[model samples]
Target: MIGQVVLNSNIMSVNLGLGVVLVVQDGVAKVSGLIGVRSGELVKFKKCGVDGIVIGLLKDSVSVTILGSDREVQQGELVERLYEVVKVPVGYELLGRVVDGIGNQADNKELPIELMEKALVEVKAPGVITRQPVREPLATGILALDSIVPVGRGQRQLIIGDRQTGKTVVALDTIINQRTNQRPVICVYVAIGQKRSTVSQIAARLKQEGAAPYTIIVAATASESAALQYLAPYTATAIAE
Candidate 1:
């Protein structure tokens, strides 16, 4: 079982963690006195109510990217290791809902229904022998593209173009089209570094078009912390898988 430990330098113990903020940069904190902490592990500033992710391990200190406001975390504050990796909630109940990069509800409604499982943001891919081959065609409901470049079930297709070229529109349309598929297709829409107004517009459109029932919107808006934008895609992949 995993146990929680509060590190106090004054009263050191084997199970207790010892971490002190040595430096506070733009959005990262150099913490000292932490032992046996791994990269990607979550940590928190006890007095600031801010969490961080360990990004680099130095000889005497660990570089942690602050997940919230860095200005709130002061130097010499106590740092506690959560002893857990970054994770997000996953379940069918996430459908038709909106969440932030860390899986917090963003729709201004009650928390997402029945979040029965949590998945690590980063995980190893399945072996080839255990994975299904990408043989079946997956239509995008776009005539020109379907005629020119066909997409397969398990294929990675890139939609590349200059700015304002309707790339997002195409992707949104594809998600809308999945509503008519023979088998139900769960869709996850991830918006990274986008404006909150834009995300709200997309959500409204999806709901208006009757596609919101099976779609999950994961948003890390530009107004939020950069850590959230960095975690947006990984969180989406974890939930989708």
Candidate 2:
């Protein structure tokens, strides 16, 4: 759980988890793979005829290798991943229309099923779409900006200018456009070296304009942890996806 784990190598056995062992007993002790357990220097668990052991100290998905006479830890056991957890996406397209959050099929009144994979904010468009032409115009949500500079869908708009030239303002306006158009694109703002007051102010503004649910902000001015800042966009993207 800490660094990297290879469960396939030390797979003792596979279990139906029906209070039974699926392997041949070697001696007085019988080890069950249905025991979802692990062992550190501190704790371990077992599912034998003794008192049911539940190791509370180790992290999730613990691995254990019990010792017994003439017993061997086998491999290639298929541990069923039949987890009960489920995640639902906010936005899903149906028919010919789009929708906002809360599982409403705003487009064609079609019901979306429980998605197996969580939605991602950003993903590579299908390979077939990669070669499509950028013919559709993407309104950047600002009248003044778009009148001066228009951005088409699949367009890469590069904002290159000196400080205080409204680079961030341009980005915000584009995000705002999505909400108005009913194709609300999620925004993940990574504010590097930004003032704390400025970040707070912008967050407040976004929430006021009903953009907080689809908006995520990460600022590097507060924490020294680089990992936090690095993974912030991916988290936001996953939520949007």
Q: Pick the candidate with the highest lDDT.
A: 1
Tens-digit per-residue lDDT, 1-241, candidate 1: 0011223432442356758887889899988777888999999899988889999999867899998788899877888889999988898778889999988799977874344688899999888898889988777889998889988988789999999999999999999888788664788999999999999999999999889989999999998888989999999999999
Q: Model 1, residue 68: displacement in angstroms?
A: 1.4
Cand. 1 Cα-lDDT: 0.86
Give lDDT per model, in order.
Answer: 0.86, 0.43
Error of 1 at 206 (Å): 0.6
lDDT of 2 at 41: 17
